[model samples]
Target: MALNENEVLAGLAEIVAEETGIEADQVQMDKSFTDALDIDSLSMMTIVTLAEEKFDVRIPDEDVKDLLTVGDAVKYITKAQA
Candidate 1:
């Protein structure tokens, strides 16, 4: 079964928290991953890996750059599943 949007969001939040040393709840949906979470390129790539593993989907490298926020990541994963 494909993961739902909420699940994707939650998973991403967890990944962000684990990788960035921030609390999962601190990650707002609208907040920029880079600015809010202080995520650098290496961290972002780790997030992409975690997302792909959790959702069982492959995200392209080019698309990774576009996922700047939690909402963006959710949208990308939801779209990929569809």
Candidate 2:
């Protein structure tokens, strides 16, 4: 089954909360994972790994640039799942 933006967002929220110690409720689609959440490269890599496992999507290293924001992550994973 293909993933949707809302579903991606929810999954990402859980990932972000677990990885960054940020509250899931505070994870907004408009927020930037690096700027807003202070997710460094290492943490982002971990997030990507967990997201790939959780959502069954392969987020290539090159594609990592496209997932700067929460909404960007949702869109990328949703597309990958599709």
Candidate 3:
């Protein structure tokens, strides 16, 4: 089943929080994963791997580079689900 936008966002925030120790509530749409969350590339890759397992979506490495913000991830996962 495809998750809605809010559901994707919530799940993604949880994944980010678990991986980086950032509060889920702090994972807002406009926040940049690197600049705002201070997530390094290794952390980002781990987060991506976990998110792929949780969301059952394949986020290619090339595509990942384009997903800069929280909203970008949420939208990509949501679309991938569909």
Candidate 4:
């Protein structure tokens, strides 16, 4: 099953919240994973891995570098689901 942008974003927000303790609502599409969310490389990797599991999509390490903001990740995961 594929998830829409909102669903993906919400699920991702949950993951980000769990990992960083940031409120899920704060994980907005414009928020940068590194700057806005204060996610380090290690935490980012963990989030990516967990996202893959949750969304059932494969987000390659190389691709992870390109996902700078919450929207980027939501778009990537949404496309990967297809």
Candidate 3 residue-wise lDDT, 1-82, digit = tens: 9999899999999999898899999999999999999999999999999999999999999999999999999999999999
lDDT of 4 by residue, 1-82 (tens): 8999999999999999999899999999999999988899999999999999999999989999999999999999999999
Ranking of all predicted structures according to lDDT, beginning with the best and ending with the worst: 4, 3, 2, 1
Candidate No. with top lDDT: 4
- What are the lDDT figures for the candidates, one per model? 0.85, 0.91, 0.94, 0.96
Q: Candidate 4, which ten residues in sequence have the lowest lDDT sum?
A: 55-64
- TM-score for each prediction? 0.91, 0.95, 0.97, 0.98
RMSD of each: 1.1, 0.8, 0.6, 0.5
Which clashing pairs does model 4 show? none
Global lDDT of model 1: 0.85
Q: Which stretches of candidate 1 lie over 4 Å from their true place?
A: none
Alpha carbon RMSD to native, model 3 = 0.6
Q: Which has the higher lDDT value, candidate number 2 or candidate number 3?
A: 3
Candidate 2: where is the Cα deviation over 4 Å?
A: none
Residue-wise C-alpha lDDT for candidate 1, range 1-82, written one tens digit per residue? 7777888888888888888888998877798988877889998898899888888789999988888888898988988887
Model 2 alpha-carbon miss at residue 62, Å: 0.9
The superposed Cα distance between candidate 3 and the true structure at residue 72, in angstroms, equals 0.5
Query: Which residue pairs in candidate 1 have backbone atoms (N, alpha carbon, C) closer than 3 angstroms, thus clashing?
Result: none
Candidate 1 positional error at 55, Å:
0.6
